[model samples]
Target: MSQTLGPTIAIDLDMLQTARERAETRGESLGKVVLDMVRKSLALRAPVPEYRNGIKRLPWRNFTRKVSIEDVNVLLNEPE
Candidate 1:
């Protein structure tokens, strides 16, 4: 709520409320919570998911193909 010249961004009400609660619980300012979250997100890499009867693959490029629900089911449910 400052009129000072500074970069500003809008946050959703629900997310803001959650962040505020987190800040209160941690005895830190909301700014600190946001900054920590941003830093952690920037440090994260693509997560590898375990597939049934399949090896994990990554560094996918030009992979524009979309998978349907049936395809997802097939991948999820492997023959016993």
Candidate 2:
């Protein structure tokens, strides 16, 4: 199916430069890189489904995990 193009949007010079760099790194067009980034960001902002594997999961499950200072210190000490 053919998709309709959206209205023109203006971006700052820094944003334009970042998009160009991402395009070069991924060997994709600037438009494709920008669209992919937008899609990813939108997905993050969208609400997640409640049910998974017949279990009711919380929308904030990922963020609700407990993390202690010891865990952070252990991660920091891990050899790369």
* lDDT score for residue 7 of model 2: 77
Residue-level lDDT tens digits of model 2 in 16-80? 99999999998998889888878988888756567989998865656666899999999999999
Tens digit of lDDT per residue, candidate 1, span 48-71? 675656876555568578779999
Model 2: residues with Cα > 4 Å off, grouped in runs: 1-6, 46-80
The estimated TM-scores of all candidates read: 0.48, 0.48
Model 2, global lDDT? 0.86
As a TM-score, model 2 comes out at 0.48
- The lDDT for every candidate, in the order shown, is 0.81, 0.86
Clashing pairs in 2: none
